[model samples]
Target: MQSDQLIVFAVLAATLGLFVWNRWRYDIVALGALLVVTLAGIVPPEQAFMGLGHPAVITVAAVLVLSRGLLNSGVVDSLARHLTKVGDKPWVQVLTLTAIVALCSGFMNNVGALALFMPVAVWMSRQSGRSPSYLLMPLAFGSLLGGTLTLIGTPPNIIIAGYRREVGEAPFRMFEFLPVGLAITAAGVLLITVLWRLIPRRENQGSDQELFEISAYLTELKVPAQSKYTRRTLHELIAAGGDEAEVMVIALVREGHYQAMPSIYEVLRDEDVLLVEADSDSLKRFLDVTHLELAAEADSKAEAREKAEQEKQAEKNGDTLAQPDANESKTDRHKERALAEAIVTPGSSLIGTTATGLSLRERYGMNVLAVARQGQRLRQRLGKIRFAAGDILLLQAREDQLPSTLSNLGCLPLASRGLRITAPRQVLLASSIFAVALALIAVGVMPAAIALVGAALAMILVGLVPTGDIYKSIDMSIIVLIAAMLPIGEALETTGGSRLIADALLEIGQSAPPAATVAILMAGVMLLSNVVNNAAAAVLAAPVAISLSRGMEASADPLLMAVAIGASCAFLTPIGHQSNTLVMAPGGYRFGDYWRLGLPLSALVVLVAVPVILWVWPL
Candidate 1:
């Protein structure tokens, strides 16, 4: 092999190994690989960062923002709310849910589509008395299957289209994928609906109450007359507890009037009651630091005895007394506050930051009452617990501020409580702008990147998506991964590395039929996608697929189609796609649970896709 080819192969091998290892984020790994290849003189230094401006990167980012616009307008949510009630049968529900999500995934970001329907799935599970595990995996897989339907549906499709444009062929249009994609999606959804029993029935799958049990941690604290913190400001009292204390004051009751989400600057007065949320150890530490006593124990012994005597006398007189139910009392206390259950979104800024580190209570006026991950509640100190993308957080904030707070934190509310439905006029405007963009792409008047970006900008200009949230809506990690990997993919072809690899594959399949060879190539890409980010899988494999097709003297379109379809079949593991991870905790799924349904679906895709590709593209 030539020295340049050797260098490219070595760098790519290391990159693939690091991706499989997954110690670092995929974006960081891709960026590091780009730098190594540039410094080694394989790619010129001036062009090292050129991938940042690639059309695929721009298209992917724009699609994300547009998806956020659709979500904010309540168009998608309204549709989901209605569709989730289509039927009572399990098969009908699964089929309808998967089909709708698939259709949405074709037009918007697949993860966003899955997010919009997750709460609906949970609600359905509750209504039908079935574990969410039966429905969630199918929903997640449906999103993946749907992404194969359109250019803007997923990163892999966009990357493949950009590759075609780079290779002197017209890029694939918006609906060109629809023919084959529709077939594959229909087959996959049917398989999921029929074989739904393959998915494990996990316990406590969709019940937030069972997962967090946050009510047990809520207690009332009273400031007594002799306490040193009686006259101190709320901020001072919190500061006294130190960073290790994870206590949160949800509301203050003074003179029997409730104040929700009280400001830190508010003064603590004698006999004021505070509703606090904390674990036992943190509650004890908070009490020790602030000299606060439990409200139930605050009364004198004589007063307690008198109250007990009154209750006994009333019972003896056979009089009906009005006694508040425990659950009702707790509900009434929190009527002015909002307890939101949200999942940290992929690429959220909150990931890797602890509550104390972010000053969530101080800066955002919200408290992290509890967190759950992969089906179990976290038992560590809340202040010190670093957030992850799929972690479910029990957050306490004011009822009115919950929506914007969750938005700013890069979290998606899992319940309807924090969801905002925009004005009908705004919704209509957002829909019109999106439709115009799609029309432009369909007519070839504008490229996918320009049309989508224009639509995103229009959303911002018209106040559909706020100016402050545009950047937040885009998943920068995905952008960086695509942009950084583009150059490396080009380097692989430029250095003849892809040609060498193609020759080896051709030699191995020298006697196999063309259809079998295509299946092998697609299966290889499918397995690679299961181990790494699907976008990276497509970027690295597209060049090789092109080379393989050329070596076999066949049409490159069929091979590229294989690459696109195979790149999106990341159904074997949660780490394969963000959609899978997002549903893992809520479904209470284990690592082994995926392949039970995924393996068969993958085999079916290979069986169905190869003939479909040949019939459509004429390999």
Candidate 2:
């Protein structure tokens, strides 16, 4: 081998070793590899950082932001609400979940789609009294399968298309991937659904039930003056809770006295406090659908007096105190407030302190919505409750205040998500913008990267996704991993390292048919993807595939398509895809657990994708 090729090979070997070792962050390892290659005089100094500006990198970032906008607009939530209606039948549940995730993956980033549905899967497992392991792996695999169906479905497809342009060919059209991708996805989804029994049944991991198992949240809501059910019978009101019977109406308070187990026949009156026991999603849905307002917690006498004095002084100074509005415009509240849960750490100063003592609402512009403590049913007022070290608190605050508030309060954030009700109009607007971007790409009106960037910007301009969260939505780790690895890939090609590898591969496949050669290349990429990030694997494998195709004097389309299929089918290990990693904790999955189902599923992908690619692209 040439001296330059030897250096590039050494650097790449070390980089892959580090990726599998996983001692440091993948991004850090990739950056180290990039620096080593540049110092080795392979990649030019001026072009070292050019990968950061690559069209593939920009497209990935834009897709992530658009996915977040769809999430924020409640598109996923709307779909999940429908999924919950399917009963406890495991087959029905798995089919519905996999299909939903697959459909979402086709249009958005697959990782984002998996995240949106993970909580739902956990909740479903808990409700069905089944192991979450059965559902999560299938969900992860379904996402991988679905991403193959569209050009923007996954990063590997975009990278392969870009590489085609470098080889003096027109880029693959948006739907060109759909044929093989759809075949593999459909076959894989069906196989997993029937064989999910192969997945291990793990214990103690389905949901964030540890923090919430104590009891449901108990809180009070007052019947607003504009409520349609002001004079409705309690029986009628409870019936309005819909099919969900989890939430219970605990007690009713009228005229400052607790009504003695008020019967369902009793009428609900305006300004009367009704104490309800329910989980966060149920409670939010009940309140919004019923038009009930959260009752303000009573402050201590001294605090109330101080507030009255401040109001009097303001009146004398010709100033009016603004009453907080329940119907406040979220656009006006541009900071985008949110409801989230946090647990007080063991050494937190918040321990043993009451919300009233901390003056949390006045000082931090935050509200303690509910608190959950072990072995306790907290029916008391939220503000008067003294927090414990292990207590989980449901808090309402601006999105920007969350990290700082959690850090300052010495609390750890929990994975237990809270619910938000997005207006239908917002969902329509965001979905429309996303659709137009896809249409632009399909008709060749614009390139995929430019079209998606425009869509993301429109989402921000229309306030579908908050401007401050645009950067937060983009996964910087994945971006860094891709950007840093691209230079290393370039160095390999520049040093003729890819040709060497390709020659070796061709020698091994020389006795085999061209179609078999394509399958072998696909399997190699899939194995590499199982250990490293899929995008990095694609960048490294693309040139090798091109070289192999050149050696055979055959079309490069099938070889490139094989790389796209292989890189996306990272099913053999949890570390292969973010979708797989996201489910590890919630599903209580071990490292060895993935191969049980993934091994067969991955083989099936190769068995199916190879013939489909050859038939469709015609090598």
lDDT of 1 by residue, 220-249 (tens): 998988678877899889889997787788
Point out where model 1 deviates above 4 Å.
Answer: 206-209, 239-246, 284-291, 299-331, 416-419
> For each candidate, what TM-score against the reference?
0.93, 0.71
RMSD of candidate 2 to true structure, Å: 14.4
Choose the strongest candidate by lDDT: 1
Q: Candidate 1: give the clashing pairs.
A: none
In angstroms, the error of model 1 at 458 is 2.3
Score residue 497 of candidate 1 by CA lDDT: 88
On the 0 to 100 scale, the lDDT of residue 202 in model 2 is: 73
Model 2 local distance difference test score: 0.79
Models, CA RMSD each: 3.5, 14.4
Q: Give Cα-based local distance difference scores for all models.
A: 0.87, 0.79
